[model samples]
Target chain A: ETAVFQTPNYHVTQVGNEVSFNCKQTLGHDTMYWYKQDSKKLLKIMFSYNNKQLIVNETVPRRFSPQSSDKAHLNLRIKSVEPEDSAVYLCASSRTGTEVFFGKGTRLTVV
Target chain B: GQQVQQSPASLVLQEGENAELQCNFSSTATQLQWFYQSPGGSLVSLLSNPSGTKHTGRLTSTTVTKERRSSLHISSSQTTDSGTYLCAIAASGSWQLIFGSGTQLTVMP
Candidate 1:
């Protein structure tokens, strides 16, 4: 079974539209994270959530938000998407200071 | 600015050749991991060597926490080893994982 799963492997939306990416992990991990990979293949952290709290990457835009229902799921929502939002979004989970397991990633395109 | 930085942005090697990928971090981290992402694929954990050295299969990883740097060595490179290698770091008491710019490796058979 896939430990970490992400929905909507690919998405293409118009500008100003809203998009949400869902991520679920059954690894029984305590921490989950969202990362963005740009066209240049530069990977950067976006948000991190755990049982304790949620930490934003600081460089992330205000338009991007992360919601977690439980330790098993963390979802990313983008409001008023722009062309700059087009990139591959990856989800990962770890058992707090342990090795992380990553999902296949969702490729989003804002046109 | 990038906190975790990797060198040799891209590399190409002939089959059976050895390859080395280096990662340098700006901050002091007690934990470090090396991950590999194949073309159009997800990231997979290759090694998690924070301080000291570890080896698995044909992959060897070494990290010096005091120096805030890490290195991944691939022995007898094969076409299957061609992919992007990523380095991630996490300091003590921090759950956040900072990723470095990956090193894309291509092995020609």
Candidate 2:
């Protein structure tokens, strides 16, 4: 069973369109993270949220933003998506200094 | 710069064979975890070893904090074990995890 849930397992959208992916965790972890896996299978950390406060923000484009309504939920919104944005987005959460639980991931395809 | 590096970008093994994967980090890690991703893209936590050795079923993980390195050993590899193995480390005082480029394993019968 998965403790982290991501909706819209796969999404396909055209360029310049806005898209949003939702993620929720039932693990009661205080820290959550978003990572992007590119075509080369390299995972890159995009954002980290601790107790609903932004902690680590990588050098991601301004078009990408993380929205957290509560500690259990973190949603990703991409504005004017581009072709290069096509990749698998993973959501993970963990308690401070512990192993993280990850969602199955949302694969986004920009055409 | 990549903080974590995984050796042998890809590996192939026959059923019943043993496989070893390595992960080296650039800094001291407070938490180190090994994860397996199936071909379908689901992530499963295999082991978490900051230091010392830990085992689960056919999988064994050994971490040497002093050397900032870790290794995962799979005994009696099976066709079902064919997938990607990823190593992640959380630096001391950091809330985020740095992931190493996964090592893809292919087990054939």
Q: Tell me, per candidate, how large a share of the native contacts it keeps.
A: 0.82, 0.82
- Cα lDDT listed for each candidate: 0.91, 0.92
Query: What would the TM-score be for candidate 2 when compared with the true structure?
Result: 0.97
**Over 4 Å off in model 2, which ranges?**
none
Give candidate 1 regions above 4 Å deviation.
Answer: none
Residue A79 C-alpha lDDT in model 2:
93
- Candidate 1 Cα deviation (angstroms), residue A59: 1.7
Task: Report RMSD (Å) for each prediction in the order shown.
Answer: 1.4, 1.1
lDDT digits (tens) for residues A1-106 of candidate 1: 3699999999999999999999999989999999999988778889989775888887899999998999999999998899999999999999988888899899
Model 1 clash pairs are none
lDDT of 2 by residue, A9-92 (tens): 999999999999999999999888899999988888999988757865658999999999999999999999999999999999
- In candidate 2 the C-alpha lDDT for residue B98 amounts to 88
Q: What total of clashing residue pairs does each candidate reach?
A: 0, 0
DockQ for model 1 equals: 0.80
DockQ of 2: 0.85
Model 1: lDDT equals 0.91
For each candidate, report its DockQ versus the true two-chain complex: 0.80, 0.85
